[model samples]
Structure formats: structure tokens, C-alpha cells
Target: MRTLHIITGLGIGGAEQQLRLMLRHLPTSSSVVTLTNPGPVARGIEADGVPVIHLGMAGNRDLGALPRLTRLVRQGRYDLVHTHLYRACLYGRIAARLAGVRPVIATEHSLGDAQIEGRPLTSGARALYLAGERLGTSTVAVSPSVARRLEEWGVRRSRIHVVPNGIEVARFAFDPAARRAAREQLGLAPDAFVVGGVGRLAVGKRFDRLVRAVAALPDARLLLVGEGDQREELLRTAGECGAADRVLLSGRCEDPPPAGAAPDTLTLPSLLAAMDVFVSTSPDEAFGLAVVEALAAGLPVLYVACPAVDDLPPGSAPGARRIGPSVPELTAALREVRRAGGARLPQPAAVRRYDIAAGARQLMSLYENAVHGTPLPHEVSCS
Candidate 1:
């Protein structure tokens, strides 16, 4: 079945990266439409040869975009329309309905109790989301916790599908050569202890807490991937913690996405291999895709927010430490992980469970079922 995927913007984050990765694996014809700014990830998607249409909506309240999107949806003649993020969900759902598309599905990539649609929920935001939600045929929650959050937010329980975010596990596999190369590229010493984290450097991620934690570790250096509005603030916070010299703030790690039949991916794994331990300081996360990528890279982890790891069976995240959202806790975890070190990167069972190959197949099957008006595959319960 032909599918059209719509997202709010094409930037470097879990949702954007996940879309590119999923496209590499799914065995169906698909195209992408970004509602606003077509940034580097848009280039990556185009490099991968998937047609990307940029709907030049000036801002969130561009009501003119609705009819334009509706016209595009009608002309695409797609069997299914899939939406992601908040604005796309709202606009795409309406456009899909306007185009007479029957099975409009949305993927809820980054919903947390702490925020809604990348903004703190104001007086009537939840009410607005619920109204937008009703136009979709179904919604895909990235984790069980996100599913629960959606239920609490008044999304009908019957319309939610739990499909965790996944990664190309083999691509993230640890490599000794990669470790050395990445270290050399980043000017890291041959034997220096490193702690790394990857995500948008937003306030909610609590990266400031990481700067504080690193201040307590004299020898352990920090490598943070992803960029955001908090870059300047985080630089100042690192300075305040006296860890400015030891921190490396690498902006968005853009790797070429796959196109056509040749899906040669980029090398975020190499950077991951250079790190001794991975940490997540997010206050709350829906599925925590970066942590999974770290696990696939075989990095021992210390995390404050990862439902994807915590919800797994006991002993899943073996040798990984779980710490609270405090400076002292993170400091101790970093020190301990550094002290008890080597590349003893123990990948959790959860890593295997969220492999992108499996997830892509499941999603493709779900799309087929949606178009045919059948239930989701027996493996995934639609309700």
C-alpha cells in the first residue's frame, strides 16, 4: 500500500531520525511531507531518495496550510496517511479527512507528562489535542508509558497502538576501530574515560544537571550530541560547574540516510563507540531511543529517564546503573562507571526487542491492515 507520512518539521531528533531509519526497513512505497522548516534531516531524507515535500507554513497558526495539505493529500492518492508530532497530527488529520483518506494513523514520538506538543500544556491545550486526535483512524504510542499518558489525556483507549521506537541495532554495534577513530576525531585521549549522552539539548532534558555531575569527575570527559536552544545556556552552566574545558558539545550528528535499495547508513555508532559510559538525564521520556542506540553501541549506561529500559524484564539492562535526577547521584554514577571500566558494554535484552528490522515489518503490516480495514497483525494488539 502507498503511504504518505507527515511531520511538523525535519530537524535532528528522535522522531526525525526514527522516520529515516524506519523508511530504510519498510517494504512499501512511501513519501514524506514536512509541515514547516525543511532542515538538514530533510536533506538526509532526500539523499535517501524518498521524495520530501515541504509545506511552507509560516508558523503553527498558518490556517492556509490546511487546504494546501488537503490538496496535496488528494493528489498523492495515498492509501494511508501517517502523521507525527503535534502540529502535523492536527493539520494532517484534518487534511487526510478532507481528502477522504480512510485510515489516518499518527505516531506519538515524544509525549511526556512534563510537556505536550513540545510546549508546557496551557489551559486548553489538552482539549485541543483531543479534538485533533479524534480525526485520526488510530494513534501509535512509542512506549507503554506514552500510551498510559495518552489514555490519561483522554485519547480513547481503543485507538492507541503501542509500537516502541527502534534503531538499526547492527549499525550501532560497537567497533574497536570505530572507537579509536572517533576518539582521534574528537581529540579524546587514548585512555581517557568518557561519558556520553545524545538528545536535543532542551531544558526538559536536564543537561545542566549533567554539567554539574561532570564537575565532580576530574578525569571523566563528556560528549553530548544534538543541538537546541539551550546551547548557550548549557555552555554557561558548564562554565559555572568548572567543567567547561572537559565538555564537548557536538551539534546535530547528520549521517546520510538510505535511499532506494542501497541503505548505507552514517556513523553515529563510531562516536558512540568512543564513549566509556552513556547517560540520560532527561526528566521524562516517552521511549528513549538514544539510550537504546547506546545499548546497541554496547555502552554501559546510567540513566534517570528511560521507560524503554525500565519497563523491560529484570536484569535487562545488565551492568547499567540507574541513578536519580540529582547532581550527587549522577556524579557518583559517572565515577563508578569510570572506575569499573573497560568496554564491558553489556547490551540489554530490551535492545534486541526494539530492533528496527522487526519494528519496520510490524509497522508495514499495520499499515496494510489499516488500508484493508483489518486488525493489526496478531503480534501487536491495536487497542
Candidate 2:
């Protein structure tokens, strides 16, 4: 079936990369519309042979964008309209209804208890979200925890469907040669204990806590992937802790280049291979895609909150350990990990449970059911 996907921006964030990865596996025809910045992930999507259209939305209150989007939706003759991110969901849902599209789906990618897309939620924001939510056929939550959060926010549980975020497990398979090359490339000594964290450097992510924790360990080197508003702040924190030389803020890591393309820089998987351990200090996360990816890479992980692992049965992810959010707690945990030494663990069963191919299949079923006016399932099993 023909589908039209709408999103706020196409940057190198988890949700943006997840969209590109999902399109790669789904068998149906699809196109993308980004409301603003058509950044690197957009380029990757286009390279993957999907048509991407950039909607020049000036800002949140741009009324002109409404008619423009409605017209585009009508002209595309799309069988289904799916949206990602908050702004896109708010606008795309209204536009789809205006265009007479009965089947509209929106994936709530980053919904926390008090924040949506890293912005604090106000009453107006909640009202707007609920108004738009009513126009869609179903709202897909990236995790069961997010679904529960939606229910607590007054959304009908019947309209919330759990479809956890997924990953390409094989792409993250640990490689010894890649590990050696990536270490040399990053100027890391072969025997250095590398501690890695991947996510936007935002306040809510609590990367400052990670910086402090790693700084306390003299022998540990911190490798932080992804950029955000907190770059300068994190560097300053590292400097204050006397670990300025130990922290490496590698800017955004792009997806793997298309097949046969000459590799220009280190891919995410290559960077993962260079790491000895992966740590996520974020106390709040919707699905914790980064933690799952670390598991796929066979890196021992320490996270504060990860619904992807927490919702599953015990032992699903043997390498992952939950810790408190305090700096001292993180410091103590790192000490224990260091005492045990660095050894790559086996890829756990949890990694396979969130396979991208499986999620795509489950999503395809939801699309068919929505278009045919069938009752949506409460949860689409990714495992």
C-alpha cells in the first residue's frame, strides 16, 4: 500500500534514523515529508531510493502550512498517512483529516512523563496533542511504558498500540578488525578502557552525570556520540573535573553509507566496536534505542531507565545493569565494572526481540487493519 510519512525534521536523532531504517525494511511504497531541516538522515533516505519532500514550515504556528500540507496530502492520493515527532503529528493529523484520509497513524517517538521531544509540556501543549490525537486512527507507542503514559494522560487505551523501536542487529555485530581500526582511528590505545554513550547531549539525557562518572575513573576514556545544545556545557564539565583530555565528543555519527559507497568516516557500528562498555545516564527514555543497540554490539551496558529491557522478562539482557541516577551511584557502578575488566559479552536475546524486520511486519499489519476499518491490536509483538 502507498504510505506518506511526515516528520518535524530529519536530523541525526534516534527517531529520524529509525524512520530511515524502517523504510529500508518495509515492502510497501512510501515517501517522506519533513516539516523543516532536511538534514543528513534525509540525504540517507533519498539515497535509499525513497522520495523525500521538504515542507517549508516556518514555525509551530504557521497557518499557511496547513493548506499546503492538506493540498499535498490530497494530491499524493496516499492510502495511509503516518507521522513522527510532535509538530508533525499535530499538523499532519489535521491535514490528513482535511484531505479526507480516514486512516492516519502517528508514532509517539519521545514522550516522557513531563516532556515531549525534550520540551516541557504545558496545558496548551497537552490540549493540542489530544485534539490532534483524536483525528488519527491509531497512535503507536515506541514502548509499553509509553503506552501506559498515554493512558494516564487521558487517551483511550484502545487507541494506543505498542510497537517498540527496532534495530538492525547484524549491522552492530562486534568486529575485532573493526575494533582495532576504529580504536586507531579515534587515537585510542589498544588497551584503553573506553566508555561510550550515544544520544543527544541534552539536560534530560543526564549526560552531565556520565561525564562526572567517567571523569572520576582516571583510566577510563569517555566517548560521547551525538551532538546537542549541551556540547559546550559538557566540555566545561569535563574540564572542571580535570578529565578534559579523557573525554572525546565525537559529533553526529551518520548511518552506514549506501552499498559500494566509499567510506569517509567512522560509522556508528564501527564506533561501537571501538568501545569497551556502553553507558546511558538518561533517567527518562521512551524506548532506549541506544541501550538496545549497545546490546546488539555485545557491549556491557549500564542504564538508568530502559523500557526496552525493563518490560521484557529477566535475563533477556544479561549484559545490562540498572543503576541509580546520582553521580556517586554512577561512579560506584563504573568502579565495579572496571574491577570486572572489559570483555565483550554475547549478543543477548533482548537484541533479537526488537528486530527491525519484525517491527516492520507488525506495523504493516496495523496499516492494513487501519485502512480496512478493522479493530487494531493492543500490541504488535516484535519478538
Candidate 3:
């Protein structure tokens, strides 16, 4: 199937990375449209040879780009138009409808009861989202909790499909040499215990708690990867916790190296390699992609709230431990996991369930099912 993917921007975030990973496994013809900020991840998509159409959306209220996007959708003759994130879902759904696209699907990547696109939930936002969501044939949620959240917000249950996020599992497999090199590159002591977190440094993520937690651990250093407006606040928080010297922020790292390209030092996988224990302080995560990535990296994970693992059965991810959202709790969890010498990654069988290729194939099946106006038997979907 020829698919057109639309997203708000190509920044180095979970949804953007997930899109890049899925495209690598998608067998059919595909192209991308970024509404604005065609940043680092855009280069990675281009490196992989996918055509990226940048609709220079000047601001949130730029309605002129709608016609341009609709024109591209019609010209491309794509079989499907899949949207990701909030703005893209709003505009892409409208554009796809204008282009007479039959099956428009959107993956609700970052929404929960608490926050929408890193902002506090509001009735106006809900109304706007529900309005745009009606234009799509299907809405894919990254976890069961998110699927339920969609239904609570007025999306029909049948239209909301639970499709878990996936990653290239083996790409994050444990690598002792890579770990050593990564720590050295970050100017960290070889044996300094590390508690790592990966995500946009936003207020909603509860990174303020993570700073205090890491500070409480006398030997632990906090390595955060990603950039956001919360940097100044987090820096001040670290100082307040007396952990300013122990906190390390790598900013936005390079995208996963493209084929035939040398491995980039500051990439996500490298950050995972350098970490001994991965901590998730997000109090309201719809799905924790980074925690699963930590499992893939063979690091014991301590989470405040992760729908990805919490919504699953016990032992879904071998080393994952859910903890309360507080500094003492996170500090104790980190200490306990570190004492356990870290944990091995989940078995290959477990990893395969969330493989990006599997998710992409499921999406293709959903697209076909939607376009043909009939449900296909045995179609893959996460429970």
C-alpha cells in the first residue's frame, strides 16, 4: 500500500523516532509530510531515502498550509494517510478528507487523562481533538490505557485499535564495549552508577522528582537526553537537591545512524549503553517507549508510571519495576535495582511482540481492512 505519513515536526522524540523505525520496515510505497520544524529526525528519514515534504507552517494558526497539504495528498495518490501527534492529526485528517482519502488513521502517541501534547488537559483541547478525530476511519493507541482514554473522550470503542509501540529490539542489545566507550565520551567515571532518563524535559514528565531521587543516591549520576523549556527549572532543581555536579544533560542527540554511515557517538542507543539503570519519572505516561528501550538495552528499569509495562501482565518486561512517584521511592528503587547487578534483556520471544516490523505490518493490515470496508480475520493488534 502507498501511505502518506503526517506529523507535527521531525524532532528527536518518541513519536518521531517510532515513525522512522516503522518506515524502515514498511514494504510498500511511503512518503512523509512534516508540518513544521523539520529538525534532526528529518535528516534521518531523508538519509533512509524517503521523500519529506515540508509544509512551512508559520505558526499554530497557519491555515494556508492546509490546501498545500491536501494537494500533496491528492497528487501522491496514497492509499492511506496516517497521522501522528496532535497538530498533524488535526490538519492531516482534514487534508486527507479534502483529498478524498478513504482510510485515514492516526496514532495517539502522547495523550493521557493528565496531559495532551505535554500541556495540561483542557475542555477546549478535548473538543478540538474530538472534532478532528471524527475525520479518521481509525485511531491507533499505543497502549490499552490510551485506547480507553480515546473512548472516554467520545471515540467509539470499535474505532479505537490498541497497537503497542515497537522498537528495533536487537539494536539496543547490551554491548559492554559500547557501554565503556559511551561513558568515556560523556566524561563519566567507568564505575559511577548511572540512573538515566530519556524524554523531553517537560514539566509534565515529573523530572523534578527524578532530580531529587538521583541526588539522594550518593553515588548515582543522572544522565538526561533530550531538550525542552524545562532545562532551566531542572538545573535549578538539581542545584536545590545538591546534585548539580552529578546531573548531565546531553541535549538532542543525533538520530540512529543510517545505513553505511558510521555510528554516531551521542545517539539514543549509546545513551542506553552508558546507563546502568533506566528510570522513568513520568507520572502520567500513556506508554513508556524509553522504558521498553531500557529493557532492550539489558538495563533494570524503575518507573514511576509506565502504561507500556503497567498495563501488561506481570513479568511482561523482565527487569521492569513500577514504583511510586516520589523522590524517596525512586531513590530506593534505583538503589535496589543497582544492587541486583542490573538485569538481562527480555528473551527474543518477548522482544518480538513489540518489534517495529510487527507493528508496521499490523498497520498495513488495518489499512487494508479499513479501505476494503471489512474486518480481516486474525489481524494483529496489541491487547
Candidate 4:
């Protein structure tokens, strides 16, 4: 079936990368429409042979883009419309309706109790979200935690589907060669202990805590992936803590690199390979996708909060440990891990639990249900 996927921007965030990965496995005719910045992920999607259209949406209040979007939807005559992120959901749903396309589905990729998409959750934002939510046929939550948050927000239980965010598990399998190569590229010594975190370098991610924690250890090197406005602040924090030389901020590393990619290309999986341990200091997380990826790489994970792991049954992720949010707690954990040495753990069941192909099938089922007017199923447990 022909489907149109709309998102706020095609940047190097979890939702954007997840969209590209899911499209690789989904067995259907699909195209993408980005309402704003068509960044690196957009190029990656195009390289995957999918057509990507940039709507050139100037801003949130640019109402003129609505007719243009509606016109495009009408012209495409897509069987279903899937929206991701906040701005896309608000506009795509209305555009799909205006074009007489009844099947519209939206995925709530980042929704925390106090924040949505790294921004403070305001009452007005929630009101707008709920209003737009009504126009869609169903809303998919990336984790059981996000599903619970939606329920708490007064969305009908019947309308929410729990489809956790997934990863290309095999791509993240630990590789000795990759580890050596990535470390060489990053100028890290082979025996140097590395502490890694992957996410937008934002305040909500609490990467400052990670920097301070790693700084407390003179030998531990910090390799952070992804970029944001907080880059300067993080570097400043490293300088203040006298760990500036040890911190490496590798900006926006894409994974599952394009076919015929350069041998020296620094993708996410390669970065994960170079790391000794993975840490997620974010006090609140919608799904903790990076933690799952780290688990796939057989890296022991220390996280402050991860609904993806927390919601799972015990022993699902043996290598993943929950730690306190404070910098001292993170510092102590790193010390313990360093003393233990950098041995890759056995690939955990959590990796298999969130494979991208399985998630694609689940999403396809949702699409079929929406297109055929079948009753969308209620939320189910991830395990």
C-alpha cells in the first residue's frame, strides 16, 4: 500500500533515524515529507531510494504551508498518512483530513512526564497535542512508559498502541576491528577506558552529569555522539572540571551507513564499538533507545531512567543497570566498571526484543488496520 510519512524535520535524532531504519524493512510503497529542515537523515533516506519532499515550512505559524501540504497529499492519493514528532502531527493530520484521507496515524516518539521533545511540557502544548491527537485514527507510543503517559493525559486506552522503538541489532554487534578503527580515528589509545553516551547534547539529556562524572576519572575518555545547542556548554563544563582534553563530541553520527560508505566513516555502531561502557544520564526518558543499542553491542549499560529496560521483565537485559542521577553516583559507577575491565557482555535478550524488522511488521499491521477500518488493537506488553 502507498503510505506518506510526515515528520517535523529529518535531523539526526532518534525518531528521524528510526524512520529511515523502519522504511528499510517495511514492505510497502512509501515516501517522506519533512515540514522543515531536510538535514542529514533526509539525505540518508533518499540514498535508501525513497523519495523525500521538503515542504519548506517556514515556521509553526506559517499557515500558508497547510494548503501546499493538503495539495500534495491529494495529489499523492496515499492510502494512509503516518506522522511523527509534534509539528508534523499537528499539520499532517489536518492536511490528511482536508485531502479526504481518513487513515492517519501518529507516533508519540518523545513524551516525558515533565518534558516533550526536550522542551518543558507546558499546559498549552498538552492541550494542542490532545486536540491534534483526536484527528488521527490511532496513536502509537514508542514504549509502555509513553503509553502510560498518554493514558494519564486522558487519551482513551483503546486509541493507544504500544510499539517500542527498535534498532538494527546485528549492525550493532560488537566488532574488535571496528573498535580499533574507531578508537584510532578518535585518537583514543587501545587500552584507554572510554565512556560513551549517544543523544542530543541537550539539558534534558543531562549530559553535563556524564561529563562531570567522566571528568572525575583522569583516564576515562568521553565520546559523545549527536549535536545540539548545548555543545558549548558541555565543553565549558569539561573545561571547568579540567576534563576538556578527554571529552570528544562527535557530532551527529548516523548508523547503518549508506552502501559503499567510506571505510573510515564514523557511524553510531562503530562509536559504540570503541566504547568501554555506555551511560544514559537523562533522569527522564521516553524509551531509552540508545540503551538498547548499547545492549546490542554487548556493552554494559548504566542508566538513570529507561522505560525500555524498566518496563521489561527482569533478566531481560542483564548487562543494563539503573543508577542514581547524581554526578557522584555516576562517577562511582564508572570507577567500579573501570576496575572490572572492558569486557563485552553476552548479547542480551533486550536486543532481540526490539529488533527493527519486528517493529516494522507491527507498524504494517497498524497501517492495514487503519486502512481497512479494522478496530485498532489495545495496548500490549512489550515482553
lDDT, each prediction: 0.84, 0.91, 0.85, 0.92
The segments of candidate 2 whose C-alpha lies over 4 angstroms from its true place after superposition are 258-261, 374-383
Residue pairs with backbone atoms closer than 3 Å in model 2 (clashes): none
Higher-ranked by lDDT: 1 or 2: 2
Query: All candidates' TM-scores?
Result: 0.95, 0.97, 0.94, 0.97
Instruction: Indicate the residue-level lDDT of 258 in model 2.
Output: 48
Alpha-carbon deviation at 134 in model 2, angstroms: 0.6
lDDT of 1 by residue, 103-147 (tens): 898999878877864678664878878999999878899888899
Per-residue lDDT value at 360 in model 1:
85
Mind giving the per-residue lDDT tens digits that candidate 4 earns over 79-109? Answer: 9999999999999999999999999999999
Q: What RMSD does model 2 have?
A: 1.8
What is the per-residue lDDT of model 2 for residues 1-383, given as tens digits with 9 covering 90 to 100? 89999999998898999999999998889999999999988999999999999999999999999999999999999999999999999999999999999899999999987788988878898888999999998899999889998888878987888888899999999999899988898899999989999999889999999999999999999999999999999999999999999999999887755455566478888899999889999888889999999999999999999999999999999999999999999989988888998568899999999999989988998898988855545456221
Clashes of 3: 0
lDDT score, candidate 4, position 324:
99
RMSD of each: 2.5, 1.8, 2.0, 1.7
Where does model 4 exceed 4 Å of error? 374-383
